[model samples]
Target: MSWANILKQYEQEFKEAEVNSYTELPDGKYTVKVETARLKESKNQGIPMLAWEFVVVDGEYEGRHEWKYSLIMPERMQWLKQDLFSAGLELEELHRLEEELPSLLDRLLEIKIETKMSKNGKEYRNVYIQKVVDRTPSQKPENPFSPNNPFADDGKPINISDDDLPF
Candidate 1:
């Protein structure tokens, strides 16, 4: 189909679809689940770093995501160790992070997030994992971000067939 025809067909959806934009969360404690984790090289220095994307599991901001990055350096190990331990992944060797990173996914924890503005007028967030929360496998949601989810972005209920019900 031509671009014009395609746009015409989806014009209503384009207007109604919500834009997924980035907005800093307010400074407060939040219960989040680790959605993704990886070890990557830092942009500038090429230093190894553990990067994480955490999804808010509940509350007013449920389904919202925030990123946390920890550089693997001697000076930064203290804080990294503390955060990892809080997430229930205690490690004696830092090199073991790669093997353990995948385990962080689906782990639930209480995180304290704070937004700070630098002198240059840029804003950044600090994510601190306060503690790991107990979550049985039965309580886990399949995929909160999936389009077929029965809950809308605002947490309102969406129409679904009886087959969609877990029970």
Candidate 2:
């Protein structure tokens, strides 16, 4: 209630805050969930743009966020359309697409992100949506009894010779 108490509480909150750095993750294909998709005016150019925020759903970078922006310019329209398509929308018109942009939120998309150093010498990651797919786990099933199993050949069991056996 007092100002001193408020300051102490704020300090405690800051002490408990988790620190996450902006280190660029390795360039790779990742399955991401669309956390946000919205149209906004660019700060410098005052041009309308579509901004997307995605969170990596799998891999070591899971929970890390990546962003993609598409300026609403004539030359960039095709790219915007492709981005929307990759987010699971197939509308052909920009106006219609804009109206449907909110639907992209929470969609699962496969994206290829590349890492590069910026002019300021800071590493950054760029998100490029490759396609939309079901939110399935990235792991493949293992078949221990199959011929292609690493421990045995097809139609054969792992052989344990007496000489090679570990006693």
Candidate 3:
């Protein structure tokens, strides 16, 4: 689709009935709430997505919408988390199915909404109606005690005594 139409469509979907609020993202780690959706082809099975939708809920571009990402369900969302972080968002700020996403998505699957954005390159959004599966990380068994240094477990932080030195 043409960028003109694409932009216009997003403008409508994200329109706040004609109101916009902006906030500056301070320089630091942050969590920006996002709304996501996914879509798939009617004829394809177990096939990768046709696209996805992602919406920003805060900051300068609050209410901005994207509908051209490649994310079809039933699919995993770990990568989505990564991409969101890359796009200046964190899971700390999320609303799933419009009901607070981070926790909700961790517990159940929600149908998401997304829109396609490009003709050639891959750029899309998880429309508000896309599907999201439980994406919480599993808790690993804790060791009896903390190691001296995590890096030392890999030997990088290990000290080399005089004889151990590879000089």
Candidate 4:
């Protein structure tokens, strides 16, 4: 149930069903300000590639106003090209979408984590959802978001799109 696990173990396999099917950024995407984004470049069985990231969109963030950017494997421009075309978007628009990607992409996975041991085994870190729960609150109101907030934790599960939510 931790993002650390998912990133360390299942990222590649899980991506097959996701990256292929999902090739565009949504209209209103965003990421938190405090959190930073990272990128990794690699050769996929001799194929060059890159990973663009917009980090920390699922926590008590800086109000969805920022996003980190990276161009992993620029050698593999096809991925980015296809994604932009699908969305009818441009490269700069990718950053705009990055800010909102975590929330939108969240709907595609359940809990967004797959636990696994790290190269130097010690403690398990979250790699998918990163942190499922954000204990700290950057912005708090006089009245806490009780059972009436849009994201209120009601007894029954809230309805979301199966196409975009977690497993």
Top candidate on lDDT is 1
Candidate 1 wrongly placed segments (more than 4 Å): 1-21, 117-123, 135-167
lDDT, each prediction: 0.84, 0.81, 0.42, 0.38
Deviation in Å, model 2, residue 28 alpha carbon:
1.0
Name the regions of candidate 4 deviating beyond 4 angstroms.
1-38, 43-75, 84-92, 95-100, 109-167
- TM-score list, all predictions: 0.67, 0.63, 0.24, 0.21
> Could you tell which candidate, 3 or 4, scores higher by lDDT?
3
Q: Which ten residues in a row have the lowest lDDT in candidate 1?
A: 134-143
Per-residue accuracy of model 4 over 35-80 as CA lDDT, tens digit each: 3332344444443332333343454432333222223346635655
lDDT of 2 by residue, 1-167 (tens): 88998788589788999998777657899888888888899999899999888899888889988888988998888888888777778886677766787777777899998888999999776778898876343346667656666767556766667998688
> Better model by TM-score, 2 or 3?
2
Number of colliding residue pairs in model 2: 1
> Tell me, what's the RMSD of every candidate?
11.2, 10.4, 18.4, 20.0
lDDT of 3 by residue, 82-114 (tens): 544443334574343223223322122233343
Kindly list the per-residue Cα lDDT of model 1 for residues 1-167, writing each as its tens digit.
88998779888888999998777888999989888889899999999888889899899999999889988898998988998899888899887888988777888889999888999999877889899895432245746556656567655456578899898
Residues forming the 10-long window of minimal summed lDDT in candidate 3: 24-33
The residue-level lDDT of candidate 1 at 105 comes to 80
How far is 144's C-alpha from truth in model 4 (Å)?
A: 14
Q: In candidate 3, how many Å is residue 143 off?
A: 41
Worst 10 residues of 2 by lDDT: 135-144
